[model samples]
Target: MGKKRLKHRSLFLLGGQPGSGKTSLRSAIAEETQGNVIVIDNDTFKQQHPNFDELVKLYEKDVVKHITPYSNRMTEALINRLSDQGYNLVIEGTGRTTDVPIQTATMLQSKGYETKMYVMAVPKIESYLGTIERYETMYADDPMTARATSKQAHDIVVKNLPTNLETLHKTGLFSDIRLYDRKGTKLYSSIETPAISPKPTLERELNRKVLGKEIQPTLQRIEGKMVQNQHQGTPEFQAIHQKLESLQLPPPPSSNTPKIPGL
Candidate 1:
């Protein structure tokens, strides 16, 4: 008789904006799988920091340069370690860029795991509002911090969503891909449908983000409330907002473009 073969487990990559309901879906999937899945969330590591709340405030302003690198390193290390042990992983992240998730997916695929990708397909404004609402309710003691973090999340969703979808389609890394709206509705599925451009509303939202104007009214409203109470908005918040507005992002690359290297 031939030697017995070990069946490899699956890797589920759950991608979404900060408040696009990844957590809830992850929980549901975990329960459905009967605790057979291990979830690796970038924010989980951030929360492990002694100054987690404070780091959330800092992340609003300097996430890219100051916060993300540390979290990314930790996340990468954890994923590698768990994959080597042959655990089924439900890896979740913002999917702000195609690079990390693609790389992670490719690595796990090489390790004999089947990979699947799911992106939250909620509207940017709705996701932004959800962030604010979640933080306001969950962290009522720190409205200012909530506003800041929500704004940061809003920006990320606006800037990355279209490209993220396009990239996922182009890479063809996953055996299956899906898009779920905020209500857990499956709006699209690669297994059942053809590729399509992001909705026009999404494109407009991206334009607004690149122009740095989408979150201004919300910021102004929050700042107005704070100033009414004789409290001031943090200088970092103002500075980062201004910087984002002044910067210009390049056009999303064509789908026909080659997949990113090391993916």
Candidate 2:
């Protein structure tokens, strides 16, 4: 008898801003797959370091620059090894740039693997707050093991996310692409009727969240409440709160936003 092919040899690409809950969603997907998937999260590699705690304390945000290259090489090697064996794979990233992801997707597609992408559609204000809260919880539980997201890096990813998402979709390398929220709720799915495209839907939702008249007032209220809270009394959070208060989110691209070529 001839060897049978496995349809489950799939690759899932998970990308979002740093605090957009990619890790949580990855965990959920892994659980649903019952550990049948190989996860390639760069942060997972960073956290695996023996001196991760000490490094975070010593270098703070610069910790990533010092150690990420080694872990990144390891991740690349794993992708190569696992894809050869036809294992279902899940890769997580901030989608800060379109190059690596597009390249990875193209590589996997050439291997006769079905590639799928899931992007988190989270508001920047909410995601920025999420980063602070995540650090606070992790640092409180175990200072040595806690890893903090760089504010500068987080902001960069936040700024570039829309463009990155659009670029990936336009590439047409993945068979499917989905947009999800922090709570694991599916906000938009590309496989739905093609009449409803991802770009316009993503643009509208993101704009509605931050470009409205209520945004500034809402931010002020959050900042005032944060000031009253004991945990949020720290100077770091105060600076972030102020930044969010003054943040000027871009409006929907309207005429400038490109349509998804064939969509």
Candidate 3:
């Protein structure tokens, strides 16, 4: 396959406490900047993982990862699309964001677009609790929200396991398998589903370094809260709101347009 040329956008990252009303601020900023903006949140695309609440009812349910929309693919796609369009961005997500921000900064900087962070420094325990609260409310309204929340929370669990084990015994390929070696110590791997056996030598090594799942989600929740605009009625907020209102979107192209004659 041939390599495709990538386009970039200047994103203004807005991360803080979960349920901090980041969406409200995003709306305000979009209105203010008069530049196109959209969230990379769960609503960006549809996710399929039915019955997460039922699954969570089982033992060991951690909830943040279950609902977050900032998956690896979605993140990369948003960055690439933004780069191409060169539009102003106001991203909203939980705190423990991965290399996307740094990578995006370096990339846009090279292209002459500036980037800034609005980090919310707060307590981790408080942040984690906030995420749970947001999802509980979100799931009540959106089915997709429920599934994403379950997936994110499971991600937290997989990241919080021991790394020193030389070997992991597997009675089955996925979660149904028994994971302890004869020593009786439990093993941890990303294969929550029965897709792959955790007993593979290389796979075991990869899973070990990932222990520490709770940290990022906790950070995200706090980040979400701090960045919220409680007073959208403020002058600055209203300015942005008005600018957004002034934008004139183009109509969709007509279906009668002719296609190329040759393939």
Candidate 4:
């Protein structure tokens, strides 16, 4: 039998925080481009370990730290092997740091692959809630196999996201950079290649200043729900409430404030 050949080799990186639906979006991209695109997620490898459930049960919040090294090695090996074979690939990451994606994109680009990036521009508060909701739902379905995202991990990603976005943009590695909300709505995109004649290049400044206002409505709604459910009193819920409150926009600078003069 002969090795299968891909018509066009491409690398798609779908990135977001821990619970921002990267898995679903990655699956959709694979399904849409059925033949050659292969998914290389560390979580998939991590979950497949025979002792994974046991480790999760034992370590709880610390499980990811214990097992991620093994998963990362496997994921990296797989990425290298698949790339060498001329396969189209889709990988998911937290986008917490630029090192992995930037390195991967650089390697694949050198291998005659077109690299593109999709960012899930979910609100920090929504993603924080998402992690809790996902864990509870999964735990209800099957306690042994359930996974919980740690608050520290989620918060670290959220805190570094603005810098990560700017770095990725400045690198100019990806031909297509897209931002989508939790509901999969297209919030922004920078497509630079085979340009469209009519549409001018649309670039959205995706930083804390912009996202702070964007996340306001969702934050308010979630806080209201927490109160209505009487969950605001619980330790976990209270912690979440405090986090959301901290994300609230700051007061505008007063007009009466004196401005510095160049003279």
TM-score of 3: 0.39
Candidates ranked, most accurate by TM-score first: 2, 4, 1, 3
Ranking by lDDT: 2, 4, 1, 3
* lDDT score of residue 208 within candidate 4: 28
Query: All models: lDDT?
Result: 0.62, 0.69, 0.40, 0.67
How do the residues 137-229 of candidate 2 rate in per-residue lDDT, one tens digit apiece?
A: 666665555567766878788677777777777777777778877677878776774434566655555444555343445445545544544
RMSD of each: 11.7, 9.2, 23.9, 8.5
Kindly give the number of clashing pairs for every candidate: 0, 1, 38, 0
Stretches > 4 Å off in candidate 3: 1-9, 46-71, 120-129, 142-263
Q: Could you tell me the C-alpha RMSD of candidate 3 in Å? A: 23.9
What's the CA error at residue 8 for candidate 2, in Å? 4.4
The runs of at least 3 residues in candidate 4 whose Cα sits more than 4 Å from the true structure, single-residue gaps closed, are 1-4, 27-35, 50-61, 142-145, 192-234, 237-263
In the range 1-263, model 4's lDDT, one tens digit per residue, is 13354757888998778877776676446555664477787887877666887888898766767788889899999989988888888888878889988999999988888898877776555566677667656655555556778778887886676567667877889877777766666666666333331012111222223344455565456556556545455555555454455566454544333321100
Q: Per-residue CA lDDT of candidate 1, range 1-263, in tens?
A: 12122366888888777666787667546654666788887765654555656766766534434555677788888888888888888888777788877888889999998888777766565466456445544334654333335466567665777777676777778877776665666666677755654333335433333223544565455444444444435443344334333344543443333321111
C-alpha TM-scores of all predictions: 0.63, 0.71, 0.39, 0.69
Candidate 2 lDDT (Cα, 0 to 1): 0.69
Candidate 3 per-residue lDDT, tens place, 1-263, comes to 12223254345555434433345445444554553554555444434335445534542234335533435556667766756656665565443334454555567666656554332322323333444446544545553434223335533422322121111112111112223221223343334534443325323432333222433444344334323524244332343333333233443444333321110
Angstrom error at residue 58, model 1 = 11
Model 1, position 177, has a per-residue lDDT of 75
| Higher-ranked by TM-score: 2 or 3 | 2
